[model samples]
Target: MTNRADLHTLTGAYATDSLDDAERAQFEEHIGQCPACAQEVRELSATAARLGLAAAVVPRPALKEQVLRSIATVRQEAPRTEPGPPGGTVPRAPLRRASRWALAACLAAATAFGATAVWQHREAGDARDQAREVQQRTEELASLLAAPDARTRTAKLAGGARATVVVSEGRDRAAFLATGMAEPPRGKVYQLWFNDKGTMRSAGLMDPERTTSALVMKGRVGEATGMGVTVEPAGGSPEPTTKPVALLDFPA
Candidate 1:
């Protein structure tokens, strides 16, 4: 149904009893022509005669000459080219052209369909890979949330003008999502940090597009009592460069 015209020859082949009714009728409609159907019928005649011969009795040896002479006469006779039953011309030339074109088109279409199917299969495989990576990252985040000695907190990281904080809590183990008035300079990244009383530990990295309510880092951490974000160098900084962009008072 995706391509109605494509089923014509297959239907023609089918209508001659080579295929069943559904496919035969479908292809006939697909061809949208009468000459194609007639050609298919004619081509099928020899095959039908072969089927009939299995049950036929052998002719007497004396009749062989008579049968041969009749065949020769039939071959020499001119084929009738009168109009068909519907008063339509029994188109011989058009039928040949249409069938050849239809066959060529079918072959070309089959090749294109095969290629498209392969490409889509590859794309689906790549998507599955990406999905697997995301699932792994979520598992890592889950482990961090379930740490037996885990400490939780939220902080509004205060930067130059405005700030945002990491909201890591509960089974979700979310991270820095919102932001206040601050911008990372060129080629710099916003790094997530968890301050345990005195030492600042890296939670992960954040990007402008990574800002979301359920934000989480692909890595895991432990004993994080407070959350902070800061403008760090390209990858990340060993320590916080500026004040906290946002801070959250996590539960002990």
Candidate 2:
């Protein structure tokens, strides 16, 4: 019996109809209750259909004629001479037609399988890219904390949760790390801003559900003298919609 993980991997093959009878039965049973698997199968099937349509092309007149002429020159296999029960020897024309049908079926299966593999590869690549981006951000935060000119300041939010910002003028970057953050009001998220003297520029929005987060700010430190956090509507606004819950001033 295949485990759920193994069964999940069969989605691509199942979409392509490349699975054998037993495996297909197992997968069909699995998909009946697995919404994720069913959704993936639907998407892959649609992709395969588009790929088939895109790959379609009419054969050139000369190529068609050449293939027909070449077929006459090809030698056909001899039919069996052994005596059969009642019908005797099977006719050669039907055997030839059967072989052609088999070849066409094999080609179709190959095409579908190829489409599945390509779709899977693209999904894996996107996952890898997201992972790479996360790793890069983590590294930047680490470097900012280690900078010789780095200065840190901490401020308490409305609910006693502490938010810390590390600003490094030499690195021209700042990082914000906080834990124990309380969830904002419904349909709201926490937004960060860089205070350039009296001017406040948007930094980025924090994931409201996360109690702990570490991130490098969006823009350069430049002339920004302070930072603040505020609760804003989901997706955030161009300007702060509420007073800051926390504020930190960069060390001189």
Candidate whose TM-score is highest: 2
Alpha-carbon lDDT, every model: 0.48, 0.67
Candidate 2 residue-wise lDDT, 1-252, digit = tens: 776656766666787788899999999999998786686666555434422321222334565576689789989898664554475544433433333333333333332232222333367788577546655554555455545567777667667676777788889998776756788889999999999997889999886766566677888989999998889999988988898888889877
Error (Å) of candidate 2 at residue 5 is 45
Question: What's model 1's lDDT at 200?
Answer: 83
Clash pairs, candidate 2, are none
The most accurate candidate by lDDT is 2
Q: Which digits, one per residue and each the tens of the lDDT, describe model 1 over residues 175-244? A: 3334233456777777877766767877777654322222354334355566666778888888898886
TM-score of 1: 0.36
TM-score against native, each model: 0.36, 0.49
After superposition, candidate 1 runs with Cα above 4 Å error: 1-126, 139-183, 213-223
